[model samples]
Target: MIKYLLNQSLLSMKKRYDYDVTYMQDILRTDLGAFMKFMAFQTMSTHKGNLPVEALYAARIRAIIWDDCGPCTQLIVNMAVEANVDSVLVKAIVDRDLEKLPSAISLVVRFTELVLAHNPEADELRQQIIELWGEKGLITIAYGICSTRVYPALKYTLGHGKTCSRVVLNDEPVVPKKNPQLVGSHHD
Candidate 1:
């Protein structure tokens, strides 16, 4: 829905991030070609269904990096799997408000995000689902997250969408202090 990196910039900047990579910050102020590609690769994912999501994600992400794809399917992938919904039918899901459907279903959305955000997010999702859906639920969540993360990232990278995502830094500014010994100690 939020098309283009301009708007996305505002949203992303408003949030606090955990790390600070120079290129991550540099990409935002400059052209999106490299930045978009980075995110598409970073956030990129693959579902593979009945197939391991990790493998699928790796391949999907690789395609964008190597083959180059678009973002339309990526958008669909981003939203569907979490709803326990099928991304292939994302265009015709009837109502696309699964985020507000019900906590029971909404949990899928949040859990899916965690999986992508955290490589091992599946562990937590599994633990939570163990009480209810049990082992099957955990596997399903892992698959969904992996599946969902791929396309959107791929699409953005390949050009399906036009959102530019960037990372900011919060750590102490690293000052390249001059080494007293290397400065003028020997200068007479």
Candidate 2:
């Protein structure tokens, strides 16, 4: 596990969160209360609406991949899986096989990529996003994508980032259909 050096003031914030602040919370709060509020806004703002959280998560995965923030990439991958995103969808995202994804979700990924790359074609993609997601949904998705990018720079600069986790990215089946220990073992 990556460890953050927290000071007395940060410790107080951690205590308020029941001493269970997330990795980003610990690091951002290290700066001061205002920075923590900024971080909070980025994460919480989009979550206030009924937008598809899975699509937002998918967009995040794509953004972090483009940013080459390994730890954030791995963290988002784990989160997507835990959120019960379809394994096939998660695999497609991890594999960067965008064509394998549904057009609706893949549109968000492509838009995020183009935006981060600052390609002029991103405007075209943004238009497409607006058509599919509506202006409000487009705004939500765009904000979510941009917001997620900030954490990678922070973690990478702070030396808290790691190479993307293979265990998290691997497409290997996480749950066994049958218990290996129970195979050929006597059971009532």
Candidate 3:
């Protein structure tokens, strides 16, 4: 229902931004006002930065996971690619293989996770980030992580939240088949 409304809004905005909106249809359908606000903020954030784009993206990605926003998560995969985050790193993140990423990025992911979870270890993680990236860097990371968390919360509040089912390696999510025979592994 809301998805349908958001799609209508996107159709109107399509001329404004030259890109496919199909991946983001769910978000559009949920809340057009919030969607527009996010698009504006995303454009602004990407244009100016204290932290490296990849780090910002990593933080946002972690927040998206914390949000468990399926649509938002999938959308960020494309956004990260546009931001020049290496495809391999993005794949590692989607695959839950943080070990494959550089220590700095992986640390950012972990720290974001702790912060979102309100874990006591967040302070220690903050210190580590400060040592690695300095005061400005820490601030940049905080800004990115903090700012990125709002949308997902809003989505959840609106009851549009969804767990991501796709493991993004490229353009599409790898959705497993329900049938054991079709999926290649039988359940006991």
Candidate 4:
């Protein structure tokens, strides 16, 4: 009975976003307990305590792009758009056009990049995030960054992930820029 409801939910999501959910289906079929745990972890990504929708989604977009360049990235982009994040800001992040992004979002992009790259240079940026949004805000952004990576990782590990594909925004296809400027660079 629970699986029936879960499948209905997943089907709705798949239809709404035009996203593939075979990995999630596989997980559900293989282990109900693991699927439940995975769904619980997904809740962590949705908590944006005190963050501007733009800042939180920026961190999520950046982190997902770091881990994936294909369907997973497209899913995040689609979700961000649905949440009403500014389309221009979403494009800038997708294109890695740091120059076009506002200061707050630029900080988030660079910070997410540095954190993903395992560079300690993110320390100063972390301080800035806290100053602007408090500890909960920082935590929200951290969760955004961390949780976005899991879907792609799980998909690929399950052999259900795809290679890079064009991402569509507002009905237009966008070729996301690869490796744009990061912290300590002239763009900053």
Candidate 5:
């Protein structure tokens, strides 16, 4: 009964986002307890405590792009748009046009990059985030970064991950730019 309801929820998500949820379905089939736990963990990705929409989604989109450039990345982009983040800003982030992003958002993107890469430099950016948005906001961005990576990682581990594909925003396809600094850091 629980699996039935969960599958229905997954189907709704798949339809709403045009996303693939086969990995989630596989998890459900493999172990109900594990599937329930995974679903609980997914709540972290949506926690935006005290963060502005731009900052939260920027961190999420950046981290997902670092870990995946295909479906998972596109899913984040879609969610960002649905959350009413400006389509133009979403495009700038997708295109890696730091010049086009607002200073605050650009900072969040850079912070996500450095954190994902395990660089000590993220410390400075972290302080800046706390100043701008406070500790709760910092935690929100951290959760955004960490939780956003899990879907793609799980997909790849389950052999369901795909290669880079064109991501669309507002009905137009956008080619994502790879962060040169993070190139070869992972996903090589």
Candidate 6:
């Protein structure tokens, strides 16, 4: 029901949500666990303002997605590791002088905790992170800022401490199949 409702909401949002349904279904057939994680991660990122750096965190975090659990785990791990490297080192890998990854990743992990735990964790996490990240990293953050609820306020919100982007539902969740009684009631 939640999945259907969210899909309907996306449909109403002017063809902006363009996740490939068939591809997602295929993944659902193959490995449901990873699909659930990906879906949960995206869903948690969308509605919750608790996700730190709220906007940029989701954008950077979603840079990679895969069909396989192993690959998906590695992709998320890579995102985590990228957050720990120096810009010069990262620049060597991607041929760009990007310095935002470290801060973005750090905040994202912190945001993850905020989503799972709550405000107390967020406060402690924020305090510990105050000196590590600065204004530029915050400014460069762009993805998750304009989440689903905020989508309706784009024209007014844009350039006013808000962001605008395509909103995609994570993936359709799988309903476990229930076993059927053998045509009629069976005697024990």
Q: Best TM-score goes to which candidate?
A: 5
In terms of lDDT, the poorest run of 10 residues in model 1 is 167-176
Give per-model TM-scores. 0.32, 0.67, 0.65, 0.93, 0.95, 0.25
Question: lDDT value for candidate 4?
Answer: 0.87
Tens-place lDDT per residue, model 5, 1-188, is: 88999999999999999998999999998999999899889788678898999989999988888878679888999899899999999999888899999999999999988888888899999999999999998999989999998989998899888666778888888887778987777542
Order the numbered candidates by lDDT, best leading: 5, 4, 3, 2, 1, 6
Clashes of 5: 0
In model 3, which residue pairs have backbone atoms overlapping below 3 Å?
A: 2-29, 3-29, 6-28
Candidate 2 clash pair list: none
Kindly give the stretch of ten consecutive residues in candidate 5 with the minimal lDDT sum: 179-188
- lDDT for each residue of candidate 4 in 57-133, tens digit (9 for 90 to 100): 88999888777867988999998999999888899999889899999999999888888877778999999999999
Predicted candidate 1 versus true structure: per-residue lDDT over 99-169, tens digit per residue: 43344443443344334334355466546555655665555555544544454454455444354322111
Clashing residue pairs in candidate 1 are 5-164, 45-149, 45-150, 46-57, 47-147, 70-155, 71-155, 71-160, 74-151, 74-152
lDDT of 3 by residue, 1-188 (tens): 65566577777655443334543565565667866776777654443356777777788776666555366666666678877999888766655467898888888877776676666777988998889878888877777776666656755665555544554546566331121222222122
Model 3, CA-based lDDT? 0.65
Provide C-alpha RMSD values for all models, in order. 17.6, 12.7, 8.5, 3.5, 1.7, 17.7
TM-score quality measure for candidate 1:
0.32
| Residue pairs in clash, model 4 | none
Please give the CA lDDT of all the candidate structures.
0.38, 0.62, 0.65, 0.87, 0.89, 0.35
Model 6 clashing residue pairs (backbone)? 55-144, 55-145
Error of 6 at 185 (Å): 40
Candidate 4 Cα deviation (angstroms), residue 26? 0.6
- Regions of candidate 6 where Cα sits further than 4 Å from its true position: 1-106, 115-117, 135-188
Distance (Å) between predicted and true CA of 2, model 5?
Answer: 1.7
